[model samples]
Target: MHRRHAPPPKLHPHPSPLSSPATHPVPYLHRLLSAAAPAVSPGPRFAVEDYLVDTCGLTRAQALKASTKLSHLKSPTNPDAVLAFLAGLGLSSADVAALVARDPKFLCAGVERTLSPILAGLTGLGLSRSEIARVASLAPRSFRSRSVVSGLEYYLPLFSSSESLLRGLKKYKYFLSSDPERVVKPNIELLRECGLGTSDIAKLCLAVPWLLSAKPERVQVMLACVERLGVPRRSGMFRHALKAVESLSEEKLAAKVEYLRNTFRWSDAEVGIALRKAPLMLTKSNQTLQSKSEFLISEMGLEPAYLAHCPVMLCLSLEGRVKPRCYVIKFLKANGLLDRHWTYGTIVRVSEMVFVETFICPHKEAAPNLAEDYDAACRGEMPTNFRFTWTKNRL
Candidate 1:
């Protein structure tokens, strides 16, 4: 019996479909249970990308880029509170968006611990709510910086008006990060040593706050540059010259000087004289210089030397003030109503009210369209046929 036992029956790889359920209850019940169980749900997920777009006003691309940096935000709780708090502080939606765009991390900052305290400190330093909103819009990181309080403490005293503070903050957001004792104080002292008065220093701060935060070496270089331009340190125009020189790079200053020399055929000395008279002329674009020079020299028959002497005339608007007034004067002279002795200097330098009273109002009877034509020219709608007779008279 043991030696002749038949081989065991072969088993199929799969169970037969016709097999009785009772015969293979384990496998059948396993399949049935699997089919009956509910699908395993995914874990709870945060929709940060959607949150950025729908709530924060970020574009899809901006939201994607900002999301990577802000991946830690598991929900919109913190950011929503931040936006609400900022809105309570009078920040518009656009302002909040600008702030968040500038520094997205600001959206995650703790409202009570970080943002509220900074705003309170700024308000304590006399910044109105609107100004705080502006500062936040311009430099959002300033709110989180530990140096903000100290920066405000040092700068608030320097500015007399809220407008000056606003301007300074808008121009130089790094005022919060800059070391007042080291950078600002030294630069201000250097300006004082350069013979700038308190009023002049205030004006400089209002005009160019970055200069106050300039490195000591750069401040020294700017001082030397202005002095080399033959601007007397004791002169009233010294502050203006310093501002002009500091505002421009050496390359820009050189280029502007060369442009004036080559275009106007002015000697280097004449160029320097012009800059001394009106340092702001260096701030004008090359296009402005070209247009004004062409009009004054080619059309008005004014000498290049006269322009170099009266550089302020070059600063006037070519279309608005200069051309319109010149047209009025020419119309008067063409009718023999204007005095031949009246100088271009007199015409260009008068206040707007005086100009209208003397040129536009009195000449209405002689030239009915004088005011209309002047208005048209001032609006940059110069008539195509507009022309003026050039006189060789000295002004």
Candidate 2:
């Protein structure tokens, strides 16, 4: 087209008056200012604003602001020097002073805690104290103190001895189940069977540090908990137990136990007997089809592998118990085994097994719109079931 109009001439950036060799690199001037700043000594020779602009390339206004903020920490009369030192660290003078005033003892304690294991491990290699101190100091933040002596003292003895950091961590586990009210009774042997090791146990403590504060007896209760749940020896009860604690509320736990009794055809007395035993004893056996299958029932959770070893039985008996037929249907549907088509005639014959294995419902697929309703029932979400599933015609 009509030869593109000549492009407007680019305006060359006017060279700054401060761009001469002496002032060319502003950042370099700041670096120079930083290097020239003296340590915190009682002297009032340097004026903050004059040095900031002349040496650090800062505007007079910025220099004034920095000086004012830093006046209390560095000598007020020589603020420029202290400001430069702090600016080098990308910190304000106020920040520097605050950091300086903070007690470092807590920091030292933390460092000692972290280094205790490493220092012990190195002692066996015949490292000298001076060498150790140097290495520990170089290891970083807050290790430069004499007070950490006790921390080191406590850990140093384990070096070269048969004991190890792992052993010490394990000692923490024994403390967890000591309290009577909160005892966990985890099954360590089951944990081992589940492929967990000493390292895993240590990791568990780290994940829940409060476990260390737990009484040893309470910890024992938790460790033996899987066994008490009556889970099979071959199952991964330990992991299941951990998940159980996460998912099961007290009401849910009881409901789940009841489900187990119904699903497995366990009698009320049988379920009660199992639960009454020590938690470890629960894991000693699996659900059994007892001789009186007509009178008893048992069921377990979807993840009942852990509960298999627990002593709490989920079973209830229909032999002497009386309830409305509607109640029985609700219970069966709640546990997910209810089938409305079956009349009272069909259910009563196998009442024990059917009631244990199935849930009750007054109608087919009751509460279908209740999202996760089916799952919640399967999980025994209800607190209690007042009746049992019954049918009359089929028998």
Highest lDDT: which candidate? 1
lDDT values for all models: 0.80, 0.41
Q: Please give the range of 10 consecutive residues that has the lowest summed lDDT in model 2.
A: 291-300
Give TM-scores for every candidate, taking all chains together and pairing residue i with residue i: 0.79, 0.24
- Candidate 1 residue-wise lDDT, 1-395, digit = tens: 55888989999988776586656778887888999998898867888788878888888888887888788888778999899988988987777766776788887889888878888888888788887777777777876775787787777767767677777778787766778898999988998998887778888887778887779899899888888777778678788887777768888888888998877778888888887887777778899989887888898888888888888887788888998888777767776777556778779999999999987787665566677778778898887678533333323
Model 1 local distance difference test score = 0.80
Across 1-395, the per-residue lDDT of candidate 2 in tens digits comes to 57778889886587554665656687777888989998677657546456445644455665665555433333233334333433443544444333322321212232333445444544554555444543332222323333333333433342222133224433432332233223322333334555666555444444443454455555455545544555443443454354343324456556656754765455666554445432222222223323112222222221333233333322222222212322354455555544456543234334544544453332334433232333344345533542332333221
C-alpha RMSD between model 1 and the true structure: 7.0
RMSD per model, one decimal = 7.0, 24.2
